[model samples]
Target: MEIRAIDHIELFVEDAEEPAAHLRDGFGFALAGRGGAGTGLRGCESVLLRQGGITLLLTAATSADHRAAEYVRQHGDGVGVIGLLVDDAQAAFAEAVERGAVPVAPPETVGPDGARVVFASVEGFGDVEHRFVSRENRAGPFAPFIEETGCGRGGGGLLKTVDHFAICVPAGTLDATVHHYREVFGLSQTFEERIVVGGQAMDSKVVQSASERFTLTVIEPDTSRDPGQIDAFLAAHDGAGVQHVAFLTDDITTAVRTGGERGVRFLSTPESYYDMLTPRLGQVGVPVDELRELNILADRDHAGVMLQIFTESRHPRGTLFYELIDRRGARTFGSNNIQALYEAVARQQAARPAGLD
Candidate 1:
């Protein structure tokens, strides 16, 4: 039952090339490998992109009966599988199922001798599934069927690893979702908070593995108060799903600059947010002027200061987005910035076209 780290994340899209190219051109991810019917992966095509320690697999179904097709039809292009690296896939899968997790797939071994890998799956939140992967024999590529293409590596070491996943569930499912992760996966609840913005409010909790390499921020809207962006996300997305994925970097200023030059659009913070920065968080690591210019938000916890920014959702459904975060000794999530983020997202939702939803 020892989960090591996140192996990779698999996204189900209508056309793998579209999102793969977007990540390559916009985020500096390199096309590392590919697989499809020719590689014995029936009914779906996959493109693997990698930058630093992050690996993203974009998959699109070619036939009507494939799971990818169903996922795309239901949730649009979004995360379908979160691969977790484990010491033993069989044991991990068994332990998870025994802990009341719904089983998706049994453990199966593949690849040649000396480079074999074992994989199993269990149902996660909504349509997302957790794939338990054990690469005891790491002699070959990520998978036996994938063919490496050696595309030019980009990003210039900007992003290091996945900081966390921000997930949005239904109104009453927040506590149950948190309890499921704690009981089924042995993840600990690290943080929790209730954020109220104007007339709307929402509850959130953070769960992480023992190693702290993996984290999930589970959020639920306050339906009784007023309908907000979280409610809009649930309705448009059709169910619970990943709202955004945060990437960790050593220097967020440079990351934001590079991403902007690559045509990545980030959410903007009002000048008033920085006008009171000195009084709110005191002197910060990054200059207030630079932060204001980049529209990056900064906050300080008891540990240290952290800088973060969110990207505008470009998804057709406006359900998924990305986040870039730079943690300078800060251990907790940006609790103080919760209200700011909530307000910013509320503005974005308000500005959307009348019929886009």
Candidate 2:
């Protein structure tokens, strides 16, 4: 399977209007469109939002019986569906089924304008779902629901577009999930690492197709030390769910500065970590002084180098968040950044009030 880039991500939310406004006012995403039909979906609406090439579909259930409503009730507010763009939706569906991917829906087509879209989903890790989409005619907005409004000018220097997302799976399932992708989508596991951070450990693997657009990093934390967040996510979600969405930018310093100006909270790397930079980079090409000033973390394997930083989760659900990454020529996630992020997040978690009824 030659999977293309990510098409879009659908989030099952409690109230679309409020969150949509947050994205608009806070992150600069515009309302692209909406959707609902007479098929018991009259009240339910899907809001389309875009930043550069990335698209987010936020759907809210108006009635109790709506499937979106059920998803919210069972999993709280989190990512429910991830759409993967493929050259042929029908062929992708057929291949997945033949490779033992459980079918969530048969290939379905709906057309309003001269354009047409064929989509089908297969069960993915945890309670989440993956939809395969093939668009034809390329008319109207994404799907029939959205109204197709522009997302407006960039705010806080948002970069080129949304790139890819990183999701966490259960511990010990890394290899198994990698195999699943290989058998079902013909994806190849291009990178692997066991990252140790702040006395915590996580195993990760990257799977990609020929086009490079369809890249996904799967992570699973070592559970023996403590009931790590990855395990908690799996337990709560009843399987694997999206952990974080990574946004790409040509220049991360501008994006960070702009996002910070707009009040987007980014995780902080300790000042102490900078002391080791002189020995770590040695004669590496990146300007160490510049990296230190920006607080961007870098590391390299045989393939190449990657720079990455994470933003704090803004949602009350504590499930979905963002990653601002600059890949350069590297295909691997920055391992040096892992421990820094883990410690920062642990501090945030510790500050929150504990105990809930």
Candidate 3:
């Protein structure tokens, strides 16, 4: 499959309003389009929000029989569809299906203003789907099936595009998941890491497309170690699902500040991590104290250095959250930062009062 960048991501929620408002009123996203009963979409209501190169489709079920409702009931409010931009949707779907991917939806073509687009879907992790999208004649934010609503962006511009995704699977399913991406989408497993955070251990492997436009960090917990965040996620989410979506930003300092000022809660990095930075890696792109103040973690590879920080999951079940990443000529996702993130999450889990929302 000749994959380009991520076209969009569809999140199934109990109601489209709250998440849509969060992305709009808190994060800077403009309501681009919509589809519902009036738009000829039955049993579901969808709101498309856009910010820079990121398009998020928030869909809610209007009826009990809708798939979105069933997904929400099983996995809670989470990602169900990951749309990939490809040169040919039909070819991509056919190739994937032929390569052991279970077919979800066959290629369906739709055009508006004489421009054509073809959409197809295949099975992904658990109940999530991999939607192949091809804009043969022209490219647009959404398909022609949806009408533009002209809902303007509220206030967010600090963040830009999706950086990568951290996918948490069951302890034994990590290898199988990585193999599936390799066999179906032609993504290659690039790097691997085993991190032990506060006595809990997890192994991670990264898979990237040929163009490096799409990346999936597949992680699984070590059952012999302490039951930690990944375990907590599986218990709450009911199955494998997207753990966190990392949004790429040009200025992570500004992005972190904007998010913090807007009531977005992020994990805290210990001062010791910053104190040892100069001795370990020497001076990097961003100052150590500044990063520590913002609770942003830094790491470097042969390519370059990068800055990143994660927000605490706001979902009631603690299953979904976001990360802000700024890569400065850095092709590799921060390895040290992953350890830091694990510790950060561990601290959060320890401090959360039981029975609290």
Candidate 4:
């Protein structure tokens, strides 16, 4: 059960082409490959998008009997599979199932000797599944059926890798979810905290693999407190799911500016947040003026500083979004900025028309 890294994420959508274009045009992801009925993949079509170390497979069902169709119908377009790169897919699958994980797909292997790949699936939180993958060739096509589009080298160098995933679960399920990952996947709890913004509150726990390459911030709403965006997400999404995916970057200023020019709208921060910056966290690496202009928030830990910003979700259900994070020697997530992010999202929710959420 040695998880190397996050291999790739599969998103189930109604139409793959629409979201594929958004990632390509707005977020600098390049078209890497495709698969459909013509390629022997019956009942569904998929588009493969790649950045530096991130691969996103967008799949849409062409028939009613496909699993993607039912997933989209219930939860809307969202993360369906979290592919975990493992040392041995067969062993991982066996271990997970032996530890009480419900198996979704049996082990399947393909390709020739030097380029062989094995895949297996187990049920994760809610409707999402964890696909264990082991590949002998790192640079080959993602899957046997996907046809390479010759754009494999076209990734922009802005975003490096996936930093972590923010997941929202039911109120009483937080501890159980953390325990499941710990016992089944061998992940350890790295951090935990309870965040309270005004009267609304939520609890969160961070879990990471041994290599620290895969991380998940599992959050749950405080049922006794006022209703908030996390509650709205469960209602609109019909269940627990991924809230946002954080992408790590090298430069905050350049990444935010480039993303903005490419039609990525980020959430705004109040001027008052920056007005107290000088007295709060003194002398950050990035200029306060630039951070203010981009509406980026900064936080510091014992290790170093990290700058981050959230994108305005364009999803019709407002359940999924993305995050751009620049960690300058910072080992921890932006804990101090959590309240700022919560307040910003609360403002957005408040501004929406009545009953829209």
Off by over 4 Å in 2: 37-43, 138-140, 150-157, 235-238, 282-294, 301-304
lDDT of 4 by residue, 127-224 (tens): 99999999998777788788878766335679888999999999899999999999999999999998887888889999999999999999999989
Better of 1 and 3 by TM-score: 1
How high is the lDDT of residue 119 in model 1? 92
Candidate 1 Cα RMSD after full superposition onto the native fold (Å): 1.6
Tell me the TM-score of each prediction against the true structure.
0.96, 0.88, 0.94, 0.97
The residue pairs that clash in candidate 1, if any, are: none
**All candidates' lDDT scores?**
0.90, 0.74, 0.85, 0.90
Residue-level lDDT tens digits of model 3 in 1-357:
888988889999998998898887667678899889888778999999888778899999999999899999998899999999899999999999999999999999887655678899999888889999988553443665577776533335777778898888999999999999999899999999888877788899999999887899988899999897888888888889899999999998987887778777899987888988888887777877898889988888898888888998878787899988898878877877766787787788777789843
- The true-versus-predicted C-alpha distance at residue 256 of model 1, in Å, is 0.3
Worst 10 residues of 3 by lDDT: 136-145
Q: Give one digit per residue, the lDDT tens place, for model 2 in 38-153.
A: 43246577878877667788889887887679888876767888888887898999999999999999998776646788889998776678899988753345765455564442
Clashing pairs in 3: 28-156
Kindly provide the TM-score of model 4 when superposed on the true structure, using C-alpha atoms.
0.97
Across 1-357, the per-residue lDDT of candidate 1 in tens digits comes to 777878889999999998899888888788899999888798999999888778899999999999999999998999999999898999999999999999999999988777779999999999999999998654346886778786533445688889999999999999999999999999999999898888989999999999898899999999999888889889989999999999999999999999999999899888889999999999888889999999999989889999999999988788999999999989877878877787787788788888887
